[model samples]
Target chain A: MSGILHIAGLGPGDDALVTPEVTEALAQATDVIGYIPYVARVAPRDGLTLHPSDNRVELDRATHALQLAQAGARVVVVSSGDPGVFAMASAVFEAVEREPAFESVDIRVLPGITAMLAAAARLGAPLGHDFCAINLSDNLKPWAMVEHRLRMAARADFAMAFYNPRSKSRPHQFAEALDILRAECGPDRLITFARAVTTPEEAFNTVTLGEATPEMADMRTVVIVGNSATRRVGRYVYTPRSAV
Target chain B: MSGILHIAGLGPGDDALVTPEVTEALAQATDVIGYIPYVARVAPRDGLTLHPSDNRVELDRATHALQLAQAGARVVVVSSGDPGVFAMASAVFEAVEREPAFESVDIRVLPGITAMLAAAARLGAPLGHDFCAINLSDNLKPWAMVEHRLRMAARADFAMAFYNPRSKSRPHQFAEALDILRAECGPDRLITFARAVTTPEEAFNTVTLGEATPEMADMRTVVIVGNSATRRVGRYVYTPRSAV
Candidate 1:
């Protein structure tokens, strides 16, 4: 018997942001797998077992889910935001590539409101124009590549969203990123730090590239740098639809 | 008493993909405003006035919503996908900027599953790495700017999602885009055209830049151009987490 393995996004932290498709998938799953915090969001039930793992072990978690589904345990791998955006969907796909026997497993990637969009909603459409989303963490890619990409994005005048901007270990990289942005985007360009968005702890600070500090961001923040035309309308920050 | 204005996203087209927050907003709305198709998605109920307008009248629609809210109407302006991403949120903010009197109106932007993320989920994590979303329509921006941004994104090796790829008025631009992409990213690079995503009409096609044609895309299609590291892993396309 073939069982399904669903990679689902739980949105940011709010249950109201969760899609009914994901809710239905959770209800049908026999097992839920993910990082500790994400799996913790799923309600435990009589037939469903939750497997919560730590960070940096995405491959292991994905493999476990694949193996369980292959053995007829219906599984769902949870990610905080959209599974395809630097989340579990890619990890599961990578696991499938590693083992040819896992190719036949039924896998579906369900989308959700990612942190950047959620923050953008609360901050008022900073990404209302052409934009780029870059993962600022150097754990996967080279630091130089990040710099190069940031420069390219700035030169293109694309609004930017950055994930994993500042973690304790890579704290200095975000500072360097800020320096690079100050150089490329100018001091007056808008930058917003949105933390724990859509949660009870949700907080936002909108400042210019000149006013922005590295300390404003942490691991839980999603940073948005507006394009050349982005500005404040009343209390909200948004990039106008039409280009100048 | 003050009425609230909720700018919400209805997700792609699936009722199941709509977020609970958006659903709740609709249930509380006394007036719903949006383009004809999007307004049609909302269920018509007693005491709710559905104002379906035509496209390209975004500013007018936004102004109407604001006026209604100022008059103490519980207004909900709907957009397909996330309102913050090239949608109604920016337009509303633009309207607010135009009319200083509308400033005191209570407004909130709610997030939804944007088309790119939904398409990426269905296509198996094509945007698993750093990516950009660009509006290809030259209705707002100059043609040269679009070309320049495309070149920059290609240089950055950023995966890309393009909205409003083609319409009858500007079919030639997408053809020009393909030529530029072929020159910059080369013919062998992968591109996926996903149309009417998350709906009964949803369809997908994954082709290399060499094999692609302008006819593959339309206004309804969201095109994804993979990064250099993106490749096929079994039936799915993914960019690996670890950068080489």
Candidate 2:
């Protein structure tokens, strides 16, 4: 029996934002794996198995998907955003690297609307120019490296989108990150905090770095900091294509 | 008469990658405006007027869309990828800033699978970690700024994605960019070229910096350069979630 694995992104929270490709993939899938909330997004159906796990067990979950696929079960490892962007695709690939047995299993990644892009869309193209996406969580990387990246991105004058900006595990680091950004980019830089974008609870707040507070961001919020050229026109914020 | 404007993404060239949000917006549109190829992607109907324009005229196209909307035409401005990413969203907002009459047009940008994310999905998550997206076309920005961004992105150790990596107007600049990248990122760095992603002419190639050539990329290609921790697993390439 032959089986294939698809690392698919369901896109932010809205079903409307999810792609037809992912919808099709979900339709054909015999097994779906993801975090608890993401797994809940899929309707329960016959002949399908849903394996929902905790967030931090990405490696174990990836290994499980690979194992299921190796056992001739069609598997889909679902992620909320684009799977390749700090999501399940890397974990699955890393799992393949660690276990030689999973190497031969067929795997493909399907992209979706990542959180930053969804947030950017809501915030009126704050990332319209050259930009960087950084995950602010220190779970996998060091805080110092995060600080270094923040400084370099600011110095380069690139618009920035930050994911996983603040969480219960490390609330204070976001405060430090805000301080670093303020020091590097100055008080006049525009920063936007978008929480639960596209969902019922969606909210957006744009302010200068001087007015931005660490309390504005949480795990659900995606933060975007504009470059020197970015500004507001009426209610919209955007960065011009040309450099300042 | 109430009119709304949705600057929407078509998601590369594949219909399957297009989001339902954009699809619904198109269904409700009285006028659809975009570049020639992107506008062609929308299906024509009795009530909808398709307005396709040539390249290098983003501002004019944007202004037209706003004018249509201001005249009580529900308009959707289509872009190949996420409209917020180096596409029509910024142009529309800039138009609003230039003309006060266009400012009150209710505008929404719908996100899609951007080329870099789509390319990363095909290449097995090379942008799995923190990454930056840079448009290499010098039509809108200075070459010096592009070069500076490349160096800063390299120094920050961020994985990089280049859109419009090469064009007939600036064929030689990509070669210069490759040289700068080689100098900053070293010859052993991994680079992947993905052409017309998610479309019929889709092609993928991965090579090291030492082996890469400027001729490898074109206007149709999205190029991704992995960070230090990126490597190949079996036939797939991926960047580990953990930093090196």
> Residues A1-244, candidate 1, lDDT per residue (tens digit)?
8899999999999999999999999999999999999999999999999999999999999999999999998899999989999898888988998898999999999998899999999988899999999999998889999999999999999999999998988778899999999999999999999999988999999999999999999999999999999999888899999989
Q: What is the DockQ of candidate 1?
A: 0.92
Residue B7, model 2, lDDT: 95
- Interface Cα RMSD in Å, per prediction: 0.8, 0.8
Give the top-scoring candidate (lDDT).
1
Please write out the lDDT profile of model 1 over residues B32-103, one tens digit for every residue: 999999999988999999999999999999999999999999999999999998899999999999999898
User: What DockQ does every candidate get?
Assistant: 0.92, 0.90
- Identify the runs in model 2 with alpha carbons over 4 angstroms from their true place: none
Task: Indicate which candidate wins on DockQ.
Answer: 1
Give the alpha carbon lDDT tens digit for every residue of A1-244 in model 2. Answer: 7689999998889999889999998999999999999999999899999999998999999999999999898899999989999899999999999998888899989899999999999888899999999999999999999999999999889999999999988989999999999999999999999999889999999999999999999889999999999999888889998785
Against the true structure, candidate 1 reaches a TM-score of 0.99
> In candidate 2, which residue pairs clash?
none
